[model samples]
Every structure is written in C-alpha cells, then in structure tokens.
Target: MTFTDILREENDDVFQKIFSHPFVQGIGKGDVPKEALAHYIKADYEYLNAFMHIYGAAISKSGSREDIQYFNNQIDFVLNSEIHPHNNFCKHIGASYEELQGYPLPPTADHYVKHMMYHAHMGGLGEITGALLPCPWTYLEIGKELVKLYKPTVNHPFYHWITFYANEQVEETTLQMRKRLDDLASKASEKELEQMKIAFRKSCQLELAFWEMAYTCEEWPVRDYVKV
Candidate 1:
C-alpha cells in the first residue's frame, strides 16, 4: 500500500474520532455554538499563518523549479482564496485578527503547528508533505462527508466552511499534494519513508485533537494557575 494508505489504516481510529467528534457533528446539525466557532476561528487564523510560512519554506527548500512552482501556487491559493474567507469568518464571528494573533496558542494548536514547522525546517520534500498532508486532506474528507450528511442550505452557519473544503479546489490541491508525496516517496530511502509514516501518523493524531479543542474551546489547561 501507499504511505498515506498505510498511515491512514494505522491511524483509522483517530480518523473515525475526528469525523464523529461533536464539533464536526455540530457543523452537520447547524447547532454548533457560535462561541466554539469564535475560539476555533482565532486559533485557525494563527494556524493558517503558520501554514503559509511552511509553504514558503517548502519553496526555498525545493530542489526543482516544478516543486517551487507548485509551492508558489499553493501559497497563492492560501492567500487569495482561503485567507480572505477566513478573515470574513473572523468578521462574522466578531474576532479581530489582532486579538487572535495576540492570544497564546492553545496547547493542541501549538503542538500541531510546531510539528509542521519542525518538518518544514528539518525534512526534505516527502517528509514535509507528510507533515502538511493531514490538514487539507482530512478536512476535505470531513467536509465532503459532512455536506452529504447535513445537506446544508445557503444560510447555514458553517455553510461556507463546509463548501470550501468540500469543493473542487481543495480536492485538486489535496490530490496534487498527494501526488507530490508519492513522487517523493518513489525516490526516498526506506528510513526516510519510515519518517514520513511517523509524520503522517502524528499529524493525524493532531488533527483529531484540533477538533476536540474546537468542541471545548480549549485553552492551555495550566493557564489559570501561573505563579507569575
């Protein structure tokens, strides 16, 4: 099986949890609290900023013009298509980007983004792709599946969020990234392949935690007890 297939099979439990998680199910039912979305939107903006940086890092680290070109395209997609909509979500939710950025990263969010950064800084193409792959790919899967279950109307609270990831643009980008990972895997050493598998599995775990964080509007558990 392919690395992603193997990784997904191994972490199938996490994937199932993510899809069934209350936060995601909330979107399906149009009953999700706005407060939860408020917390999520803020942290998500921060996450997107990190994602953009990793894409830029991927460009500089890329060995070929084709890879650099793809990274440039991905960055453009994030900025032009994705980020603007995120800002709109912030506006609708009434969370200022300034406020969100200034807030400390929640623990799950911190671990997830930091892992992507670590691989972007340390790993080559396949490893970085493995680290980055879980977000868009899994979201697209969830989004597509959610839309089917919810059949959300135009006015649904999370309709835009649902449709955005469920649509062709995200699907196209995800497949391209997977194809890139496959190509990288073809030439990678067995040790490198193992690292990629590790990255993919850990990333899947983080994705599940991200949803749990959203459901609870999680902050660092120890924040209230600080000695300072």
Candidate 2:
C-alpha cells in the first residue's frame, strides 16, 4: 500500500468520528443553524489562511521546481477557489467576510494551526506533506460521502459548500497531494517516516476536533487576562 493508504488505514477511527460529527451531518442535512455555520465559515476562513502559510513553508523547503509548483498551485487554489463557498455562506447569513477574517482563532483552531506550523517550520518535505495532507484529504472524503448520503440539490443551503469539496477538481487535487506524499515517503529515512506517521495521525485527530469545535461554537473557557 502507498504511504497515504497506510496513514488512512491507521487513522480510520478518527476519520469516522469526523464523518459522523453533528456539525458535518448538519451541513449534509441543510439544517445546521445559521449562527453555527456563520461561526464555522469565519473559523474556516482563518484556517485556510494558516493552511496557505504552511504551503509557503513547504515551498521554501522544496528541492525541485515541480515541488514548488505543486505547492504554489495549491496556494492559489486555496486563495482564490476556496473563498467562493465561504463568501456564499457569509452572504446568506448576513455576515461580513471582512469582519469574519478579523476574528481570532478559537482554541482548537489555534492548536491545530500551531501543530501544522511546527511541522512546516521544523520538518522535512515529507513531514510537511504528512501534516498538511489531512485537511484537504478528509474534506474531500467528507464531501463525497455527504453528497451520497443526502443527495443534495441546488436548493440545499450548503449545496455550494458540499459540492465544492466533493467535485472532480478537489478529488484531483487530493490525488496529486497523495501521490506527492507517497513519492516523498519512498525516499525518506526511517526516522522521517516515523515523524510523518505522527504528524499524519495528529492532524487527523485535530480534524475531528475542528468539527467538534464548530458544532459547539468553541471559545476560550477563561479570559487570558483582565483589563488593567
């Protein structure tokens, strides 16, 4: 099996949790609360920013033009292509995308971003791919399953969001990343492979946590400090 297959098999339990998360299910049903979805769109907008930064880190560490191009293409896709769904959400909910971009990362998103950033800054290309692959990969899987489960129509509130992640373009992008990760794994040292395993697993766990966070509208439990 390819390295990504191994990673998916190892992390299947977490993937299942992410699939079954109420927040995700709500999207499938076209019934998630507008407030919850507004929170999610805002949080995800921030998450995509961090995701692009990791791609930048990957580009910096790339040893070949092809690798740099791959990362660059992904960065462009996230920056331009992914925003439409979020913009649609904002319009429906009357939320300002400008203000949404200004919101702070909630605790789970903060931790997840830091986790990927640490690997991006400190690890080799293989490890960076491992850390970053889960986001798009899982989203593709979730979107595909949601479409099958709900058979969403154009009238569905989240049809754009659901179909965006479920489409051929996303599937193609995910396949490219998986092939890239597998190629890197083939050349990696045993220690690097282990690091990749840990990064992949941790990312899957955090993916699940992100769903839970959105479902609950997660916020900091206590103020970091009181006003002077």
Best by TM-score: 2
Clashing residue pairs found in predicted model 1: none
Candidate lDDT values, in order: 0.83, 0.90
Q: Which ten residues in a row have the lowest lDDT in candidate 1?
A: 83-92
Query: What is candidate 1's lDDT per residue for 1-228, written digit by digit as tens?
Result: 875666778878878888899988987776777777777877777887788899988998888898899998988888788864466456667677566564566789988999998988888878989988898888898989899898988888778878888999999999898888987898999999988988888899999998888778898767644545
Per-residue lDDT over 82-191 for candidate 2, one digit per residue giving the tens place of the 0 to 100 score = 98788768877887788777577889999999999999988999999999999989999999999999999999988998999999999999999899899999999999
Deviation in Å, model 1, residue 92 alpha carbon = 5.3
Q: Tell me each candidate's RMSD, in Å, in order.
A: 2.7, 1.7
lDDT (C-alpha) at residue 205 in model 1:
91
TM-scores of the models, in the order given? 0.90, 0.95
- Candidate 1 regions exceeding 4 Å error are 84-101, 222-228
